[model samples]
Target: MSSSPSSTPWSTPCGTPPLAGGPGGADALRPLVATVLDALHDGAAARGGPLPPGGPEAVTAHVRDALADVLPDTGTGAEEALHALVTALAYGAADPAHPHCAAHLHTPPLALAVAADLAASALNPSLDSWDQAPAASALEQLVTRALATEIHPTGPAPDALVTTGGTESNHLALLLAREHHGPTLQTVCGANAHHSIRRAAWLLGLPEPVTVPAPDGTIDLTALAAVLTDLRGPLLVTATAGTTDTGSIDPLSEIADLCDTHGSAFHVDAAYGGPLLFSATRRHLLTGLDRAHTVTLDLHKLGWQPVAAGLLAVPDTTMLDALAHTAPYLNPDDDTRAGLPDLLGRSPRTSRRPDILKVAVTFRALGRTGLGHLVDRVCDTAQQLADLVDKNPHLDLYERPTLTTVLFRPTDATDEAVAATRRDLLTHGHAVLGRAHADGHLWFKATLLNPHTTPTDLDTLIALVEGSTTR
Candidate 1:
């Protein structure tokens, strides 16, 4: 490798220029960040109305036409160039802050967290070692302890590290489990468990994951017991804290019992519903979470932080030793475990971004009470939407709301009609909803995470649905 200071930049790969002041200098970034933030605000407001109709080609053509000058042939001044690029990209996307954006488990990031993201990016700190980021590593350690205390209070104080998102978090859990259980590992989970578990199993050089059927969107204990009886090798069983489609929670206490009986590693995938730990009324749903050997939570989902803030936490710090690897230059022995975790050891990523800054900022800004209130509000909103659908003459409610997702469909509408109504809703931009096939019927889905949404907004959404179907 070249030994020159300018030859190899920090964090990023060699030859790629750094973002700080490569050509445009430091003063250029202030205006750029401001302009990008403003454009995002405006774009979100416009997207709250209705969507226009088009296929990929039309969208591509329109975007290409509008952004012809925005993308550079040669780089313009950094501030102007950066602003134009983000603004063009923000034009017609779903605004998670919108009242009608109840399609997925995604939430609007807390304001302080979002601002912290900008600052972190501007500073470009790396978490691989303390030499690169001293205070940043300390903040990550504090936040990890806070999350561990919240999730596994009575158990040994857990160790955690941030990853890209829920998918990566799930992957890390399984990876650690495999290291602890050996390559002959057999994993078990409900059919409704997040798809990432299966993918993670494949990535870890294991056979396909054995799935237990969940007819009511929960793991069948008898079926799991049968599987345990026949299996002989090391095992990892995943119990879902909250599922993706219907927001259903698996029976964690029962699953923990089975894991104990069989001497298997128990992991809980709580990426979508883990924040319920903050809600007094909903905490019972995750009663046995402390018994889990490993747990995954996504700050971006219910934690109200930006994307790429998922966490994988283990009940005992020793379990994380499975992923430990040493590099002489990177983590010297005396320096390695000096009251700070080398996030690279606990996570699949190396040279990781400073994702902890946002989480730390969010925790400090929102505190526990504010976060609990937001969770309560979103759950209440989901229930309200479910009640609305149940009361409507033309609509049928499919699954009850557990955390923040409600699945329903029009009672009188056919599959084709439901599909058309969904397409029309998207094309006309009246509201954005999700659709999924369940029990031989297509169900219209809504995930309520925006607390500002009201009953009136839901009423108007139903009215629009009714109008679209009739038309």
Candidate 2:
């Protein structure tokens, strides 16, 4: 009834397929390299807030125009084609380093990490097999052990690996739990848990999640026991170290005890707050991370790394056996018999990049103390903003910031009005702060990652919010 699928992935039976192009992959990317340098210069000169001066419609139109301008034929040469693409990205993309770009969890990348990425990209190490990545295999193990130690110190290096981000970390954790505990397991998480947990459940075909409400963005411990009382099978309980909207951390010690009592697997989504472990003054906040069965951390969020740098650490290495699979052709039993390190089973994706190099470079460049200072600086900014909001009659500070995010709103704005203000600010290139709705109220938020933003920048942002409130 159906036509046979094309034999080759690159082409169909009818339309002509684009060639992989003549030799020289590295040589083709020079234009992109040059364009990045140009972008840096042009971007700095723009002297704009986080984003360019345009709202949603304007952004869409600009992207469409760029796409339309790209030559359909490859005759324009790799240099010209790549130059145009990188130029579009340079001018169109928002700059997280900008003082007013406090809308999301995005962070400005460190220079050293960027250099590491350039090297890693050039090397193109695919760590699926030792043949593909020999040294990289060892490098990943060394870095993984170090990170696992950071998360669960005092114990021998726990199981660990790098992932795309928190979502993949959560997915891998659940996949392991399901393989160990079985398909009969039920997933549980606080209402404030990252959405990835639910997605993981669906992918695993587990039962509907029993979500415990997280008022104030932290789980109500009193209600947690009641929710788990009726569960019938093996369970996975996800705790949040830093919730998305409010940056609230759950009572991890208490949650650990409950999971232990019920024989359920515990996973902590510390994608945003995991960096607190580095802060000597603030390490107390993540004290219970060591007790988690599995803990997730995202280097891209606050670790000053480029995107797609998620990590997972576990106390028991054997738990990862659930994800182990044998491939007679690629990672054959013969290889295992020879005692070669085949690390692909620990993650969902087989052909993975050695992102650990950049992570290793980040820690080396910014040691624990330096990174801790950055964390403290952001926390200080959050407190300063909180106090400013408290003093300002037009602004309402909702909760004391537990981490680096401050949730608040204008004293005189409605839910729609708050959204309207954000749109206006973006359209006019004034400021762009986070907006969210919870507890039957609309709120604005600021996630301060850029320590370079001075008190004057903070005051300017507040003034923008105040001015918007009156309008």
Candidate 3:
């Protein structure tokens, strides 16, 4: 058209226009990303202290000040902004490596796994399609198979998917159970089962789950049989591998036999105790896991992986078809059965990250035997702490630990005094412990996941609680 479109200023006039900083814009971002990675690595290594107690207002003010100072007025420089944001966030947070960080089901991530996480972030692979993440998709499949092998060595490999966490995995198991067994499907769970199982029933549009009372914090088989008699149609029974408060294990073998007799689908929520599969000493506790129709496990809690690494495993690969759906654009007819199961078809999430890299890297770094040793060490340390409690005249053992958790209370203190002492310990930031109610009394608790924790450290914690009882 007229005179070569009038030569707009935005368009390049001649000869490639300086090549956007001599090799395209990627060169400009390389150094910035490297700087950010260095800062993050160093910050994590320093063993930072806990947060200052100003809460939301202080955090918001810091954010506002940083944005005003670092961000450009006209347009945001994303890389720079991200670096500044991360630097500010790393100022104060709970150090998982700290021996006393024993409150929840959290664990210090393995060093190799952390490195793998960094690699995954840089690659930014999505598991939705092979084109997006070819190697990662294969790695996920391999890790799932490895985990299935641990549970059922003789059975065929089954289908599994990575979920957000234990909550989502439990939800998936409920959904699958409901789909297989219709609208009238009822569930039976022990009184000591994790609360998430009940929540899963509600989310899946099932009636309120039938609760089997566990008088001694272990599933009462007689009560379970009575509940099974009352339920109609297909039944779903959940057996707990490890409970929250007392770390009690349900009688899985007996529950499996009952489900078999009633023709019900048996599911196991082994999210907290699944790692015991690797420990020869404790593996017998989960004796009948292979018989369950489905099982849930959280790698973050006991596998020493980072957060959001949960899995839902089914006995047969075909069971996953219950959740399959075909999206026209997302997974077209062209890519249906090319050895790709389209992880989204089996899981609730679509745009899932390649979480399996950490698992694969961890396995390669520490072989199966090494992982088992680590788990056994943690349990041994827990027993050591329990022994301390037994030997001390001031502390009373609440229950014998079947796993790595120790629940106890002060021998001479009242319930109110125990509560006050726990509060005092939390306020001072000396150590973090847990609390629970059993038999109408509140007890102090600790979940020992850190293998480096010693009996002396627990003794000091007991002393701290005793000292604070009157304060």
Candidate 4:
């Protein structure tokens, strides 16, 4: 059970006056901060696992009741009111760290990364201009340079930027691709390429993307080559490193060779599979990542970090110059001429959060090898779940687990039956497994992130799924 009304730790006084010349210092926020922390502790320690039953309606009601009077009043001692809101927000939402919560790319954040996030939030440095965030500007450069080394260690380090996620990263890459070529251009991509790529083209006002055949969740090189040959104008070939529906990596080397033959700029969307570069045995899967003109990587997906941690890298820094502008106030010619560093030319956002801080903290805490182990753990769990699917007479493995995603559904059940199973799981506080449709069929997608989940725990999940069939 969640924290009770009588057990609420909101006795701390509220509406404290601000300190002289200091604004709301630690003393002013002490009461509310302490109460909020206590609320978090209680919420995490709730009796049943992280998620509560009843789904969206339950959580929405929790919030509505907690703040129903917010529209009318602001004079009340806010301790109880704020406490109720935060507490509801905590226990009402689904917890990704739970052993049975295998739904999406969401991962349980590391303790150190969370701490770093809190610190960065408090600082609230904008990474756009150097004066706005002096240390952040320099530090972002250093970290991005270091990250560039990881992708292409042997070659010249690509320039990097902290982006919103794979969407923005892919958008920026395609934007550059469009800029490199004139209005007359074609974009060659797999049918399974992320929707963001097509949206990026639309945003760029380019013609519709030319998609290649990908029946088996990966690009067919022959079809890709045929598309490349048939294309006449400047070509932008984008390949998938890890497809969304099925985690299948395209033959990067073969694709890279075709791009070379076509003289097209190659971009790789490695948002899901980029972390596999850390795995010693699996790194071979992305052998030609270095050859791509640009790459998109999302840390929140597999980097064990919070959301909004994404990166875009270009092997040559000049590629990003397309997005550049001479803003005299932000990056003046005088400042550029001087020794001062300017980070304003990198990304689209003007005042962006320095999420790279938390990413850096995570990297420092868990070295490359440690990060690789985390990836391996999740991938191994995926393999285990796939094995479970293979052994079960009812289930069918969509394909092998290239990363940490498993797609399967009951062989004896209908599409409605499969979807109903997922809905029942959430309604009864079982597990929040993902449900998706691909190849005109429904599938249950288990995206593993928590290493603490045991095989027995998965067996219970399987049993629950089996039980849902009768419903």
Candidate 5:
């Protein structure tokens, strides 16, 4: 009967590759890293623009051809596989590094951070237990606590959790609130808040949030007050530091006052705008941020780290008590008495990567001043883009940007034409721009996250949009 599965003969795993850890790991990785680097350069050279020519079908076909034989009977060897796939991906990538690729909040990762990520990958530390990630666990604690203190200096004992990104951070915020306030917790947020906030509430089986008007993209204080006054029982008021469609921050102090008046919990989704804390010039934009019970921050958006660098900070370590859990295999009672750090409670996730290493490296490499410079650079570039749009008689600026996002559209163009212009630009691989509806019109949304963007780049973007409208 199938020769008894356990007794079935099996040949040694084919083409066993060298590991990326231990003494010989570096020696083994050196050549493969070189191969990857060369492939990246060659592929990016082939792309020659912000994105590969042709749309989805062309990209899919190219990748399919490059990655032929996804599960080959015999191996093609590690170097060959790495080179082929990496090159193909690089060629097909929507490169955030290209100045014209200013579509979303996606940041071009910092080289140092990426390099640090490589080390983290090599180490392959699983953070669910201290034994698997001894030094890494300590590093995470140090870095997260330091960041928490930055956000809540007045807090009794501020602490933060390393998250995958804003989505996960927002999810954890809602989860923690649910644990504290019970299932009856009602979430109140602005119409302009990130969609994740509502999703988080739904995932937790909580009541559908009550939405307040964001008339000018920031919450209407009077409207929020009215809602808070009417809503009974436990309430959580979620505010937006920077809105997605328009980068407008709610009046934080005013909202906090309402929350206080109603005795409701407060949370701020600053996923897009939290990094302004680094900039001395712009820190005032986030005034009253510390008043929130929980705050979400995403470094991948503006801090220039690779994807998956997000944080959920609380004023005190005790505030996270609701997440405490025990797993005998991971963190046993004896281990705790012996002072081994129990990591399972730090997040809802169990199998977590050492994402903190890259963030720590970035913080060490670039102190407050260096990071502030990057923030200011992008903001300045956005202003320049707005100026170009405002001056172009063919274009109309939605508003003067408060942060790095600039929304503008062709003057007097139909909403349909505005949408088509964005599509035409995407199809032709000319530029990557986003679209947002504001002031009852669809506008071309240029979210400038690349600090390297220049006035010349902004001028070209305006010209391209103007030309597309005519076409």
Candidate 6:
């Protein structure tokens, strides 16, 4: 027989920690949250910059020393363990909130969204079945439909499925194409497309993608047309809305028109630029987005939510029938027939966290206009950075800011010098900037995503680069 709570093994001197759910959960969590908040503040204070000083070895040693007693015979208790680990992690983090941390597509999450995430964690709703997440499943439906409608406004019934991120969204898009047209689907993408497209095609047993040239950062229309004409099987032309190395949007309407002419299905990997739909001024950049058979969107990149806020949108709900799966226990036919929403087919993974909660909260708290303002802010900041790069005789701007990525380097620095400067910044914890190869040279790629970054911050980044290059 199962022992009573009082007589359980954990109830001895060790003392079982209070659970995070049910009636008493809030009272139990209050002190623990305070501990965590304190720890976070202390850690960030300790870490004085965007990243901890002294690169990999120092950071690793610091973490190792703090966490030496992993799986110890006796616990350190909840508060101690929480404080120690949280503080260590926060201290060692490459904090995106720092204006100097304009490296990758990583975004610093909003306070409101992060707070909503806490509620999600405490509730711990698994989205595998309707019973597991009744309200969450309903909320997911409402939010997904609304977003899908925004993407495919003219469609009769648009729908979307939440995914882990761009990689999974790309995989699902390919999987759907494979399921509909068999394993013979051949993907065609520009060289500028995200690496996930090639990986997804391989995972789905589809032929390797026919990569067209992207010499000018965007795809070459004539080359793409030639490749599509030469190919003779089931074709899926994958286009990039925002490229990785350089944020350049392909000519969407022209590509969509080409797809129509060639009788090929179109898919846009808008993972980085999808949120441009929120910006009234920038939505025109994704003009033919609705024409795609599938679109990949990653909110984590541009939408300042936490990691893993991704989606795959379709023009019609019927298009998602390919992903329809039936697990007897999770989504029984009787339950579905009796008006219960079938949750199994929504995604490939079961037992998923309600990531939608944070996203929903963010959307409700900040409507289209609010979100649009944030988008515009970052893009404008990028333009300001580009202008700085242009004015700086020591720096060379690769091109004008397309979205929020600005590629530049020391005016005449060699590729090796450019690379060394980036590493020097990382090792010294002076700043965190990314590197990209474009126009036959390695350049510093500042992917500015922080809305609060000021003009002074951009000047500081250029000054840092100038200083690094000299060294």
Clashing pairs in 6: none
lDDT value for model 4: 0.81
For each candidate in turn, the TM-score is 0.90, 0.90, 0.86, 0.92, 0.97, 0.97
Q: Residues 1-471, candidate 4: write the lDDT tens digits.
A: 333323333332333333312343444445556777887766656526647787788767877886777656444345666677777777776788887888877888887887788667766788778887888787788898788777866655467878989999998888888788886668888988999999998988988999999888889999998888888989989998887777789999999999999899899999999989888878888999999988999998888788889999877666778887767888898988897776677787888988999999998888988988988888898899899989999888788888888899989678888888898898777888897677788999888889788899889888888888776
Positional deviation of residue 394's Cα in model 4 after best superposition, in angstroms = 2.5
Per-residue lDDT of candidate 1, residues 203-283 (tens digit): 889878999988888899999999988988999999898888888999999999999999999999999999999887888
lDDT of 5: 0.90
Write model 6 residue lDDT over 312-367, tens digit each, in one string. Answer: 99999998898788999999999999999888789999889898889999999999
Candidate 2 residue-wise lDDT, 1-471, digit = tens: 212213322223234433222354344344446656775666445534567676667767766775674446434433344445555665666778888989899998888888888878777788888887888888888888888888877665486878999999988888878878889888889989888999889988988788998887898877888777778789888899998898889999999898888887889999999999889999899878898888999989878889879998987677677768777755888897899877668576888888989988888878999999988988888998888889987788888899888888887678888888877777777776887678788888898888787889999999997787677
User: Candidate 5's residue-wise lDDT over 1-471, tens digit each?
Assistant: 222212222212363556789987786677778878989998899998888988999999999999998898876666678789999999999999999998898899999999999999999999999999999999999999999999999999999999999999999999999899999999999999999999999999999999999878999999999999998999999998888887889999999999999999999999999999999999999999999999999999989999889999999999999999999999999999999999999999999999999989998899999999999999999999988888888889999999899999887899999899888888788889999988888988999999888888888888888888899
lDDT measured at residue 398 in model 6 versus the true structure, 0 to 100: 95
lDDT minimum window of 10 residues, candidate 1: 5-14
Q: Which segments of candidate 2 are over 4 A away from where they belong?
A: 1-32, 43-47, 67-71, 154-157
Task: Score candidate 3 by lDDT.
Answer: 0.76
- Comparison by lDDT, 1 against 6, better one: 6
Whole-model lDDT values for every prediction = 0.79, 0.80, 0.76, 0.81, 0.90, 0.90
Off by over 4 Å in 5: 1-14
Model 4, residue 84: displacement in angstroms?
1.7
**How far out, in Å, is residue 346 in model 1?**
3.1
Provide the lDDT at 395 for model 4. Answer: 84
Alpha carbon deviation, residue 271, candidate 1 (Å): 0.4
